[model samples]
Target: MEHAELDALLTPEAMTLLDGLDPVQTTNDVARVVTRLRAAGHGPELVSAVVGQSRLRHRAAAKFGEFAGRMLFTRAGLEQATRMSVSAHHAGRFARAGLRRVADLGCGIGGDSLALAALGLDVLAVDADEVTAALAAYNLRPFGDAVEVRHGIAETTALDGVDAVWLDPARRTTGHSETRRVRADDYSPSLDWAFELASRIPAGIKLGPAHDRDALPEGSEAQWISVDGSTVELVVWTGTLARDGVGRAALVIRGGSAHELTAPADTPDEPVRELGAFLHEPEGSIIRARLIGDVARSLGAGPVAEQIAYLTGDADARSPFATTFRVRETLPADPKPLARALRERGIGTLEIKKRGVDIDPAEFRKKLKLSGTEKATLFVTRIGARRTAILADRLE
Candidate 1:
């Protein structure tokens, strides 16, 4: 958002108009709403700001829930903001460790700060971007003195009076739209500076799930978190914020329930064995944390191939760490023959899952002429040295 648009958005008139309008859920409604507001004599800035905010509020509902209706956001800020569920978990870590005051550096749209303040922790939320900082202040206004939003560079932000710190560095390009991921060294606070600060203070640094594990600092606990099967972020904790003796962890959250598996460090890969009756695919967070071996040991399973993440075991122990599939048949490796076998089995609706292969599921699905009432998941992966396809039923 431009500085002028933001100024107009903060006015009492804009806030009232935004509050008065219903949530904008469709792109088709935007033009009508924009025209109506303009016809009502609202200036372009007010109309654009109100309409834009209405759209963002609806989009943010997935992350902030009902609280999104009362919050303000910048496109980039909302996109980079941590999910409320995850942020609540992050806040709980600090609270559990006896932390009372926290400096949330690079606090985009005050998402983490909101969770921290709600947990009764005094929060100082800092963002370098002017518009983002303003939006954060407006969003966090309900917390009163419990939260403070500041406009400053995270690398130089003051840590006075704060017992702990949370850093979510800006890892993308600058613009609100058309932003792309930059290297870890290009992070706003720079990983080097962030690591230096972490070593000196109790701190938690949030990074992408795919962040270079080799870049991790020694003695830090790296936790990978996934929400609803999607691996979201990796958090590195240092000093008192770090859980004792825990070097690696995977936290899987699905349908509001959270399950965690922790290890002292990266464990060796489970021994490769023949594919068992049941094939288990580890959750993305577990794969990212490199703790699949721990999960395999727990389930009495082993990898299907050397270094392959797919686990195989006949055990019926349902685990939250992985999705289990009951193997029905192993189809031919070639796509044409596999498609034929699937058609013969009366499989119409199919979920194509692949690893260790270079085929697009959407494109491959189009090639199959399926017509039947049965539905099954197709796994295109490698077993030993040969590529294979497994038709399996998803197990709960």
Candidate 2:
């Protein structure tokens, strides 16, 4: 098409071509639109024009996902920190705590605030950026007389007589870097300062899940939450984290493999139990939460090492905390014995798992020409610094 023709189509005609293609402003989504345009033979010039105009539109459409009032949080809160889904239970933790009035500091599109508002609480949602604040207001508008979205700095924003607070500091600036780390005293609209301004209220400030554990504040409950076998976020609750972390918090999203783990206090050190016919590898969440004691207590088992998450039992103990398998054979952690054991079992295509052993499965699999009609889960580890393997099967 000629330049004039393209210009002619630039009106409603061109608009119709891009209709329903409301692409998001995110770099990823905008790139996707550009890729699609490329496939349509819309050259770089046309693509650049679309990106400048349609990127934000695409981001909005993508996030909303055809659902009304789909709560959107800051990308830093969700993406940068490994959080994917904000479980209903998590949302309720803050909402049910009698937080009648809340200043959702750095409220990215109002994810948490909406939940609070849904609970019939009056919330003041604030974000630093003008565009984000506008989007937040647009998203929160349906609540009607419940949620008020504002564009301003949390440190200077007028936060008068609010009940509680939720501040998710901007971990990174747009140009990108760890540029924002406001102190509790420096908290926007300054809740840290506001405690003096008004009253001390329950606050939930989300930081990196990988944050220094030892630095955890006194009496602050640290919660590591995961959904569908993936660790999502670590939250520090100034007041209430949960009833009893119970070692593992499996946030199941219906038909998904539940995320499970044991808490730090739950780590087991009650002396290593004797090796049994079965070896169990505790799920990752359990390892992080240090819920081995809880898992052992639940499975009626004990740890193979004082520190390792691996649990052992004389009889098979079925547990979600660990993958349990019945034993078919055993050998020293050395290669010759392992090779012989595999040959005897006629087992090949080995599924290697290790808790304490440093032996590489790739190097070992190359040595064992094994195949079998029967199988077992091998618990590879160092028993008193001597490598060992305990073959086992899934506990019924």
Candidate 3:
């Protein structure tokens, strides 16, 4: 959105009109809403802007919940904004460190800044993009004097009186129409500069989950977080912000519950063992954090194969860190034989899962010729050096 469009969106009349309209949740809904809005005497620009915003608010609900209803967002800003649940955890880190004021570098749409202000920390939220900074100012207006949104580069933003820093360098290429992922070295403030600043002050840097681990600065706590079942982001905490004696950790959030596993360093995986009565699929956070050994130990299990993330043991052992499946039987790895075997067993419905393999599940499913009344999950992966398939039932 341009400055004038944003100004229009923030006006009393525009806000009142937006408030009176229900959220547009789908593309089909957008057409009907846009038509009704235009017919109601709203100008074309206002209708288009409001309609676009309504759709964004509906999409943002997954990340910001009810707060999305009142916030302003751009397409790219909303796409890159941190989830509210994760931001709350980030804000709590500053709160626990006794930090009262924080410099939120590269604070897109004030997502983290909002969380910080909610925790009572004064925030200086900065974004280099003019429109984004303005949108951030609007979004953070509810915080009153607690937040100051500035249009400035994070590298040059004044840091006076800031007790800590929360730097989320722009990881995507700059564009007015589209943005694409850039490498770690290409970060807006750059990882080198970000880590240098962190070395001098307590700071938390948010990076993508796939960021090169070897490049992470020493003496920091690297944490991988998974919300629901997806590995969302990796945050490296430095100085006092880093948790004591914790070098690496995985935080899994499902529903409203959180479970964390940490180690002073990466732990060695348990020895590979034969497939037992059950199979365990570790959460993405656990796999990314390389803490599968910890989960395996807790469940009295071991890896099903070398270099594989799957774990196996008795059917009774369970942990929040992994999804356990009861082993029904092993199936033939060959497609024709596997299809025939499944047909004989009366298994029709299937949930296909794979790791350490190249076959696309959707394409492979079409070749199965599935037919039956029974339903089951099929795990296509490796056991030692051999390709294997395991049919199982999901244990709730």
lDDT scores of the candidates, listed in order: 0.91, 0.59, 0.91
* Predicted structure 1, TM vs. truth: 0.98
Worst 10 residues of 3 by lDDT: 174-183
**Model 3 TM-score, all chains together:** 0.97
Residue-level lDDT of model 3, residues 51-97, one tens digit each, is 88888888899999999998989989999999999999999989999
Clashing pairs in 3: none
| Residue 113, candidate 2: C-alpha displacement in angstroms | 3.6
Winner on lDDT between 1 and 2 is: 1
Error of 3 at 346 (Å): 3.2
Off by over 4 Å in 1: none
